[model samples]
Target: MTNWLPSLENGTGPLYIRIADEAESAIKSGTLPHGTKLPPQRDLAYDVGVTIGTISRAYALLRERGLVTGEVGRGTYVQGNSDGRVPARDPVTINYGGTRAMVPPPGKLRFDTTAAIDVGQAETVGRIMAEIASAYPGEISSYTRTLSSDWLEAGRQWLSSGNWKPEADQVLPQLGVHAGINAVVAAVSGAGDRIVCEHLTYSQVSRSANLMGRQIALVDSDQNGILPEDFERVCAREHPKAAFIMSSGQNPTLVTLPLSRRKEIVDIARKYNVWLIEDYLYGGMIDDRIPLLAELAPDRTFLLNGLSKSVAAGVRGGWVACPPHMSQRVRVTQKMVSGGLPFLLAELSARLVLSGAAGEIRSKVLTEIGEREALVRQLFAGKEFRSHPRLPFFWLKLPEPWLSGTFKQAVLDADVLIDDEDEFKPARSARVYHHVRVGFSEGRERAISTEGLKTIRRILDQSPLGTSAIV
Candidate 1:
C-alpha cells in the first residue's frame, strides 16, 4: 500500500461509516487496488486522527460491505466489489424488507408484509380501550413510568409456550418486538459494537442497529436456519454483543431451527458470552415444543414476543423476558429508546391478554392464515418453495434465468407486491440466492390473495428470456 490515507473530510454519518464510505470511494476509483493490504488499524487510526476502536469498526463495516476481507493476523485488504448488498446507508437501497414502505398502489396486491391479518380484533381493542377510559381515566392522561403488575403477568401469560413460562418479574413490556430489539441492543451493546445475524432474516433490526451506530456482522446460514459453527466463528472474529434469531419458523426462509440446532447455537453463545435475542414473534404463532433459547440458556438469552404478528398489529404490544436480574437494564433502555410504551396502548394490550381476548383473536387470525396457506398449496402445488403451516409467508426460489430482483419488478408490473431475496439481507452477501418471500397475510380476503398468487405463479411459470413471457 502506497501511503493509503482516507480523508475523513467531506464525509457524513458516524465516524466509522465515514471512514468506510471513504474507503469504498477509494476502491471504486481504483485508488485502492485489489489485494492491496490496507494500513494497520493502529497506524491508520493514528494517521486519521480517530481511535483504534473507530478504525476497528470502520474495518468491520468494510467487511460487511464486501469491499474488503480481513485475515486473522494480517490487516484488512481491498477486494474487488461484486454486486452484492448495497452500502448500509444508501438512500437508493433502503427499500429492502419494507424498511421504507410504499402504500399499496390501487389494484396492487400487497403480499409483502406479514402484519397480522385483521381478525376483527379491533372490536376487542376498542372495547378494552373504552373500559380503560372509564376505569383508569387518571392513568391514561399520565405518563407510563411504572407499569402495573398486571402488565408483567399479561406478558408472562402471552409469551409462555409449552414448558417455558418466565417469572412475571422477568418480563417487561415494550411497544413491540422491533422496539424491544432496539432496547435489548441498547442495553447490551455500545456504539460501534457488532450485532451478529444470519445472512437472511427479519432485517428491521439490522437497519435499526446501523442507525444507532452499531455495525452488523453476517453469519453464514443454510435452509435449516443459522449455522452454529459460523455463529461461533463470527463470535470469535466480530465479538458481537448479541445474536438475534427466530427458532421456530424463521422469517423469509420459513425454516424452523431444529432442537439439536437450537442447542448447538445456545452452546456457542454461552461459549462466547454473546447475548442472544430470541425473537419469538413468529414462533409464538406455532405450537412447536422446541426448546427456547431462553429456556436452554436463560442467563444469556432474551425472549421477545409481540401481539403484532399473532394477534392485532394495531395494538403494537411486545414483551421481553429478561434473564435473571437483567430486566432493569433492558427496561430502562426500552423506555429511553422508544419513549416508553403509551399508557393507553399498554393498558389495552394488557387487558386484552389478561381477559383472554388476545388468544381468541390470535386463534381466528391463525385460522385465516391457515386458509390462505392452503390456498397457496392449491395454487403453487409442487412448486419449489418452503411454507410453514402457520407462517404468513412462503419462500419461493425463483427458476433458472429469473433473478430475484427482476422477478420482484416483474411481479410489481403485474400489480402484486412481494419481497425479493435481497430484502432479507442485513448487508451485501457474497453468496446469492434467487428467492422471494410471498406473504399472504396482508390480503383482506382470500379471493384477493388468490389473484396475487396467480400473478406470481404466472411469472414463475414463464421464462424471462427468449421463450419468456416476462419480457
Candidate 2:
C-alpha cells in the first residue's frame, strides 16, 4: 500500500502536506475506496520514511476535509467516494491541431515546462490598477490616449539607472516582449531578409521571425553558449540583417553567456554591421547584470525587456530602449501596433518600481529561487543536468541509454511533463542528443512533480547502457 505512495525526499514542501495530497489522490482514484481502512499511522510512516506525527497530521487533514474518518483503536477509513463535490478533472484542453494531448493538472512530482504566474504577481498588478484609478482616472475609460510623459520619463530614468542610459525620447513602451520583438524585427530586418540565431533558441523569437516572413539561420553553439568563431563565420556567410540573442539566462538550456564570450559575440556583430537584439527577459534576477550589448555597440543594438519574466505576464507591459538612430523606426512601428503603451498599467508598474516594492518583490523572488534551486540540486545531485541559482528551469542532458523521446515518454508515463529539445531546434532531422528541460517556477508543494522525477530516475536506472545516441 505504501509503495503506491511516492517518496517525498529531494522535493520542496513539508512531509505531512505531501502525504495528505497523496492520500487525497488515492481516495479520488478509488484505490482507497469508501470505507476501506487506511494503514496504521506508525506502519505507514515507517514505510514512507516520515515521522508518525506527520502521518497523524496528514490523516487529520483528510479527516478535516471529510475524505476520511477515524475510530479510536480501530484505525481510519475512507469516508465516502470524494462526496461528488470535487471538481471534475477537465484536463487542460490545448488544441494543437488535435495531435497533442491535454496536459494533466500537476500532481505531487510533475516537472513543469510551461511558465506559471501566481496570484501574488496578479495582486501586485491589481494594486497598481487601483493606484492608477485613484490617482489618475478617466484616461483608461476606453478612449485612445498616449501614455503620460511623466511615467515615460520614469522608464527612461529606470534604464539610465541600470546603465542602458537612454533618453526619455529613446525609450519606447509597448505591450510585451512579443510585440517588442515583432516591431524591432520588422523595422530592422525587412521581409525576406535573413536573421541568424543560436541553433537552439527561444521558440517565441523563432515564431516571431517566421511571422515577419524573415528566414532564420541557426548557427551551431557550444556548451558555453553560441561559439564566437561560429557566430563570426555565420555573419560572414549568411550576411544576416540582425542577430537575436538572449545574453542573460537563456531558456531551455539555462545557460548565461559569460562576459568575455559575450564581448566576442558583440564584437562579431559590430564587425559584421548586424543589428543586435538583446532579450533581457530574465534581466532583474541576476547579480552584477552585465551591460546590454546595446551599451557595447550603442549604434547597432536594440534592447527588449518586460515584466513578463520578473513580474506577472498579464501586466501586458514592456519597454524598448533602442539606439538613438533607430528611434524613429521603432516609433513608427509602435504607432502601427497599438500606438503607445497603455498608460494605466504603465503608470502602475512604474509606481511599483519607484516605491521600492519591486525590489522587495524581487527579494521574495530570490527566496523562492533559493528554495527551488536547492530542490533541484538535491534531486539531481549525481545526475547529468545543468542549472543556475536564479534560472527558472534546468537543462538535463540525459545519459546515453535514454533517447530524448524515450525519456520524455517514460517521465510522462510517471505523470511528469517536460519540454523536449526538439521544440528549440531551428531545423532538425529528428532530435540529436536527448535532453529534457524542467522548470522549477511552479513553486513548492510539487510532490507529484518530484514523484515523476523519481520515476524517471528509476526508469533510467533500469535502461540498458549505451542505448541512447551520443552527440
Candidate 3:
C-alpha cells in the first residue's frame, strides 16, 4: 500500500470531487495500479488536511465510477484502469434504408419527419438557457452524471401539463422519449425476453428492442388502437415480459385509446402479470385528458413523455415515470446505456416548465398543428384517412391498386417524402396494412405541406399507368 496524497488546491469545485478527480487521474496513469489499496480515510484526511467525511465522499464517488471498490472489513482498493474511459458496450444502431429512410431532396416538400413547427419557442428556450447559464454556471459547465432530486421534481412539474402527476421519486429525467423507452425496456426485460407492442407501433421502440436483443411480439389493433382481447391472447400465448403502448395520439396512427379501452388493457396486463410501458409522446397536443396507463397500473407501468414532439425535437428532454420499486433499476439501466441524462437540457426543460414557457409553447404548437390538420382535412375531405386534429401526422389508408410502396415512391418522385406502414411494423409481424403516415408539421410553412398534400391527392386520383417502377 502506497501512502497516497492528493493535492487539495483552492478554487476547485469541491474538496471531495477534487480528491476523486486526482485519484481517478492517478489510477489511469498507472500510478495507482489495480488492486492498490487506498489510504485509510483518517490517514488520507490528515495528510490532505481535509475532513474524514470528505475523503469518504471521494471514495464513494470513485466506487460509483467503477474506479475503486470498498470491502466490508478492508479499505478501498482501485478496481481497474478506467480513468477517462467509458464502459465498453455495443452501440445501438437502426439502419434507415427502407421506408424509414425518407429524406427528401433539398428544397423539396417534407411530410415525413413528425416534428412540431417552430412557434417562437426556440427564442424562449434560448433566453431561458441564457438565464440558466448565468444563474447556474457550474451546472451548465459540469456533467450531471446522476439525476438529482431537484431535476426529478422539475420533470414531474413538466409532466403536470399533460395531467401526469407522478411522485417525485417515481420520475426520472431521460435524454428523450426514445432513450427513455430503451432504458425502461432494458430495465424490465433481458435479451431474448418477449416484448409485445401494437401491430403498427412507433418504429423506434421496435428498433430499440431489437438492439437490446429482445424478441418483439406484435398484437393486432383496431381503429380505437390496441384491442384488449388481442393483447390478452398474445400475453397468454407468448407470456411476454412487457408491452409498449402509445396511449394518446399514437405515432403515425393518431389514435387516442379511449378510457374504457385503457382500463381493459390495464386489466389484461394485470391479469397476465406483464409490465406496461406507456408512451405519451403527443400528450401535450391532446386537449382531451385520457387516463394514462401509469395512473391505471402504477405498480407495473412505466410512462414516458418528452418535449421533442410537443416542444422541439432538438431539445431532447424527456422523463420516465417508473413504479416506485423499479425506479432505481430503471435509473441504473439509463445511466449504463446513455451515461445518464443531459443535465443542461433537463435544466432547460425545468426552466421551461417552472417559468410556464412550455405551456405557452405547447399552445402555439397545437394551434399551428390544428390549423394545418384542418387544412389537410378539408383538402382530403371524404378521403380514407385516420387522424386526430391535434396530432402532427395521420394515417392515409391507401386506395385499392395503390400499394404503400408504390404510393410512397410516386410521392417521392414528385419531390415529396412520406413514411409507409412497413417502417412501423415489427420484424416478425405477418400483418401488412397498406397505409402511409402523412405528416403536416415538417414543412416550414403550411403552403409547403399543402402543396405536398395536393400532389398526393393528384397521384391518388390518377391512374397507375406508366408507373410500373413504383410497383
Candidate 4:
C-alpha cells in the first residue's frame, strides 16, 4: 500500500468521510491494491492528524461500502477497488437450518439492530433524541398552542426538495400514515365508493380500503409501473372516487415512475376529474429527478408522506399534503377522527429531518444498499433475480420445481425467513411472478452474512427443480 496521509483543509463535515474519500480515491487510482492491509485506526489517526474516533468512523464507512473487511485477530484489508465494487466472500456452505443473526447482541453492535433501521438519519436521530431527552419535561410534555402554518411550512419545504410546492393552506399533519390514509378515505369516500389501485398496491392500502367498505379497482402494471392505458380504462369504466397510487419508489414492487409515465397518469386523472391519493412514502431515498404525482396533479391530489419509510416507522410521524380545496375538510377529518401528532415526536423528527441529517442518512443508506446488492447478486449468481438500482430490495423469481411455499419452507429450515409471493396475492395460480422480496434493510452484516447466503444457495440448489449450485 502507498504511504499516504489524507489531510482535511477544513474540518468540515465528518472527518471520517474525508478520510474514506481519500482512501477511496487512492484505491481507484491503484495506489492500493486488493488484499492490501490498512493502517490501524490509531496509526491512521496519528498519520492524518485526526482523532482515533474519526479513523474508526472512516473504517466503518469503508465496511459499509464493501471496500474492506476486518477479522477478529487480523487487521483490516482492502477487499476490492475504491469504487466499492467487490466480489462476494467465499461461500461457507453449511448443512442448513443454522443461520444466525449477523448483528451482535446489544453490547456489541454499534447501531441498533433490533428495531427496523431508519437507515438514513440514524445518527441524526440519536443526536436529536439526546437533545430532546436532556430538555425540561415541560418542553415535551406540557400542552402547546396549536396552529397549522408551522406544519404547513415544514411540509412545503420538504416538498420543495422534490421541486414541489403545494399551497401551505392545503397541508395538514396527521398522527401517521395509517391515520392519514384512514382520514382521507373517510373524507373522500362513503360506503360503496370505488377506488382504483395498482395491481401490486401496498397491502395496507388494500386493507384500509376494505375497512372503509370501498371497492378497489386493480390496474395492471408493466415494467415502468402501472400501465397508463389500463389506468385510463379503469377510470373510465369505474369512475373511481380516488386512485391510491404510489408514484415514487413503490413499496413491494420497488418501482419508481419515470417522468413520462407520471405525465401520462396525471393527464388521465385530469381528463377524468378523479381525485388522487398519492402515497409517496418512499420519497427521500431514490432519485429526486422525477417530480411527485402531487406536483403534476395538485388540483385534485392528496399526498401522503410519513416517517414510516424514510424515518423510524415506530416513531409514528407523518404529514398530509392536500390540494387547496381539500385542506379544510382534511384538517377537519384529521381533528374529528384523530387529532395532531404528539408534539414531542413530531418536533424531534422535524428537527432531525430539517437539520440535513435525514439527507445524510439517506446517502449513507444508499451506499450500504449498493454494497448489500453486490453481495446478493454474487450469491444469486445464476438465478434470475431482478432489481432497480436505487431500490432497497430485489425480486427473486423461483425455479420450476421450487413452488413458492416449498421454497419459503426450505429457507425457513435454513434459519432464513423469506416472503412468499402468493401471500401478497390471492389467486395462487395466477402466475404473478412467484418471487420473494430480498431487502438490504437488514443492515451491513446481514447483507454480507456468509452463513446466511450459503444457506440461501443450498435451498436454491436442493429444490426439486433440476438446478445445480454455481461454484
Candidate 5:
C-alpha cells in the first residue's frame, strides 16, 4: 500500500465529507491510481486523529460515488481513473450512401428498449384525452397536488387487474414508475443506506439508488427468481433499508417468483423489518395468477404499477400504492421533488381505465407480444436465452469466446441495438456474467423484429476472429 495521507487542514464541512473529498481529489489527480490499495480504516483513523467510525463513513461515501471498491478481507481500492464516470460505449453505425449512420438511425429496427408496441392504443388514448379535455376543460388547465376522487377510483380499479388491491386513499399518482421509485427510495432510505436488489435486475432501480446516494447490495437469483436464502443472507449482513424486486417477469431474466418463493421472501422481510418496493412494471403483460410481494408484505411493501409498459410510453402515468401509514409521507416527498403529477396525464389515464380502453389495449398488445415471442423462440430454438412468452425482452446468455461487450458490439455492427449485462449490474458487485437483453417491443411490425433477431443470430453464429474487437 502507498504511504498516502489526505490533507484535513482548513476543512470546512463534516470531517467525513472532507476525507471523502480529499480521497476523490487524490483519485482524479492520479496520486491514488486505479487498483491502488487503500490503507486500513483503523490505521487511517489513528493517523488522522479521528474515530474509526468517521473513516468508515468516509470510505462508505467513496464507495457510493464509485470511486472505490471494497473486498471482504482485501480492503478497499480505487476503481477507475475517470473520476467515477463510466465511459460511454461506442455507438453502432452503418454505411449509408458513402456516409455512416447510427444503428438506430431514422426508421431503423430498434430492439434495445422494452417499451410496449402500439396496439391501436394511441388512437384510443387520443380519443379519450380529447373527450376528457372537452368534458373537464377547467381541470385540465389546473394543477392538482391530490388526485381527484374519480381519478383515484380509476387507479384503484386499474390496480384490481393485478393480485393486490389497495384503496384510493392509499394510492399516490406518479409521473411514471421511475418517478415513483425515486420518490419511494428517497422517502424510505437515506444517503449511505444499503438497498437490496437481484444480482441481475432493472437498470432504473440501480440508477435511482445511485442518484439517492444509496449503496446497492445484490443478492443471488436462480431460475425461480430471487432466492430466499440469498435475500436472508443479504438482509442479515447489510441490514438494507429496502429491497426493490420485480416479482413478475423480472427484467432481463424474465423469471417470475413462484408463490412459494414469494412467501419465503416475505418471511425474510418480516424477520428483518426491511421495506419492500414491489415493481409490477411487467405485471400487466402476464397472467395475474402469481402472488405479488406487495400482497405478501402489504404493511411494508410499496406496490409500483404504471401504464407505460401496458399502454403507450407517452402516457407516462403510474401510481405507487403506499402503506396506509406512509401514504402522506410519500405524497409530501413526491410534492417536494415534482410539484405533482400532471393533471392532464392523470385524467387521460383515468379515462382510459374507467372507459375500458386500457384493458382492451393491453389485451391486444399482449397478443402481439405473444406472437413475437413465438417467432423469437423459433428463430433461436437451441440458444441459451431466457424469456417469457408474454414478456417484451429476452435474456440471451452469450456463448463462450464472446464476452458481453464483444457480443453487444458485434450485434451493433450488424445494425442491431441491445443492452449488455453491465447496464443492469449494481455497483460494487463482484459477480460477472456475459448476457444481453434483446427487446422485441420497440418494433411494432413483426417483420422488423424478426429481422433484428436474424441479425443478432447471424452475429452470434460468427467466429471470434470474424468479428472486429471494440477498441
Candidate 6:
C-alpha cells in the first residue's frame, strides 16, 4: 500500500489533472483501496518523471476532488476509515501552517516545528493577563487605539544588534513576525508586484505574497545564502518590488547570510528599488553578534522580530522595525490587514518584554534548545547534515535511493513528523536538494525526541527500495 502509485500512461490534459484522474479512477475501481497510504510525492515524481511540485499539484487536485485528506505536515491519506468513522474537522477559516505542525495528533512525535521551546511561560503570561484585565477593565474591553512607548522600547531592544539600534519611534509592534512580514509586503508592494526570495526559504513569506496577489520570483542560492549575481539577475528580470530574507538561522537551511553578500544584495535592491523585508525571527535568538540587514541598509530594510521563537509561541508577540519615516505606514497596513491587534495580546507582550519575564523565559528556552541540539549532534554525528549551534532543526541530505519525500513518509509511518525539502521549496520541482529538516524542539519531551531521532537514524540506515519502514 505504501508503494501505491498512479499510472500516468497515455491519457492526459494537464499533468496534475491526469494524475488526479488516475487517482480518482483507482479510488472508484477499488484498486487504490481504503486506508492505502500513497507513495510520497517526491518518490512518485521521480518514478514518473515529474517535479515534486507537479506531484504536489496532483495531490492537491485529489484533495479538491475529496479523494484525499491530511497535508504535508500530517501524512496524506485517502478519505476513508476502516472503522466506519468519519474524521471530524472544525471546517473553520484557519490559516493552516501546513509545513509547521499546530497541536499534533495523538501518538505522533512532532519534529516539524521550531515554534519556541515551552519553558512554562503560561504562568507568567496568565498572571500578567489577569492583572491587566483587573487593572483596566475598560481598556481591556475596548479596541486598542494606542501603541505604547513601552511596546516600541521592547521592540527596539529585542531587534537591536551589535552595531545597529533603531530609534524607538522606528519600531512598530506587530502581532508576530509572520504578520509583521506581511504588513511590510502590504506596505511596499501592490497586487501583481513581484517579490524575490531565495530558491529554498521559509515558504510563509512566498505563500503570504501569493495570497496577496503578489508573484514570487525565486533567486538561486548556495550553501552560504542567495547568490548575489542571481539575485541581481532576478531583480533586473523579474522587477520585484520587495524581497524577504531570513539573514540568520534561516528556517530549514540554517545558513547565516554573510556580511559581504548582505552588502551585495542591498546594492542590488537599491539599483532595482526593491524593498527588503528582513525577517529576524531566529536571527536575534541565535546570535545578536552579527550586524543586521537593517543596520547595513536601513534605508530599504524592514526588520521583523518577535517572541514566538524565543519566549512563547502562543503569546503572539511580534514587532516590525521599519526604515525611517515608514513605521507609521507599516503600522497602519498591519491594522488594516490583521484587523488590528488584540488589546490584551499587545499589552501582555509589551509587559512581558518590559518586565524582563520574557527574557527569563527566553534564557530557559535557549538552554533547552542547546541541550536538544547537543542530542542532535550526538545522534546525527556521522550523517550528512547542516545545523547551527543554536538552531532547533538540522538539514539532512539523504543517501542513494532515498528521496526526501520518501524518507519523510517512511519517518512519518514510524510516528515522527519532519519537513521534507519540498516544504521549504521556493519554486517548484525544478530544484531538489534531497534534504529534510529534522527539528527537536517540537518533540517537547527529551525522551520523545531521542526516540524520534533513533527512528530517523534507523530509516536512514535502511534504504526504502520502494517499501515503507517496518516500524
lDDT string, candidate 3, 66-133, tens digits: 67877645778878544534233223322323334445567667788777687767788889888888
Superposed model 3: Cα runs more than 4 Å off: 1-103, 146-149, 161-164, 466-471
The C-alpha stretches of model 6 lying farther than 4 A from their native spots are: 1-101, 466-471
Ranking by TM-score: 6, 1, 5, 3, 2, 4
- In candidate 5, what are the lDDT values of residues 1-471, reduced to their tens digit? 977898899567667668988998888777988888999877998999986646765775576466788764678888874554432222221111111123456645677787878777778877887888899788777777556887777777766544457878988778888898888988998899999988888766776677667888888998888889989999999999999998888887888888999999999999998999988888757755676777777799998888887788888988888877998899888877667778888888787888888888888888888898899899998889988777888999888767665576556656677877766765545455778889899756788888899988888887644754221
Residue-level lDDT tens digits of model 1 in 223-273 = 778888889999999999999888888888877888898899988988888
> In candidate 2, what are the lDDT values of residues 178-269, reduced to their tens digit?
78877888889788888887877776676667756788877767777788898888899989999888877776776678888878988898
lDDT value, residue 256 of candidate 3: 81
Residue 321 lDDT, candidate 6, scale 0-100? 86
Q: Native-vs-model 6 lDDT?
A: 0.80
Candidate 1 residues lying further than 4 Å off, grouped into runs, are: 1-100, 466-471
The runs of at least 3 residues in candidate 2 whose Cα sits more than 4 Å from the true structure, single-residue gaps closed, are 1-110, 114-119, 157-164, 335-340, 429-431, 443-471
Weakest ten-residue segment in model 1 by summed lDDT = 462-471
RMSD of 4: 20.6
Task: Output the number of the lDDT-best candidate.
Answer: 1
**Which candidate, 1 or 4, has the higher lDDT?**
1
Task: Enumerate residue pairs that collide in model 5.
Answer: none
Question: Between prediction 1 and prediction 3, which has the larger TM-score?
Answer: 1
**Candidate No. with top TM-score:** 6
Q: Which candidate, 2 or 4, has the higher lDDT?
A: 2
Error in Å for residue 245 of model 1: 0.9
lDDT of 6 at 105: 64
User: What tens-digit string does per-residue lDDT give for candidate 4 at 212-308?
Assistant: 6787777888767988999999989998888887786675667778889888999999998888888876655564667878877778888887665
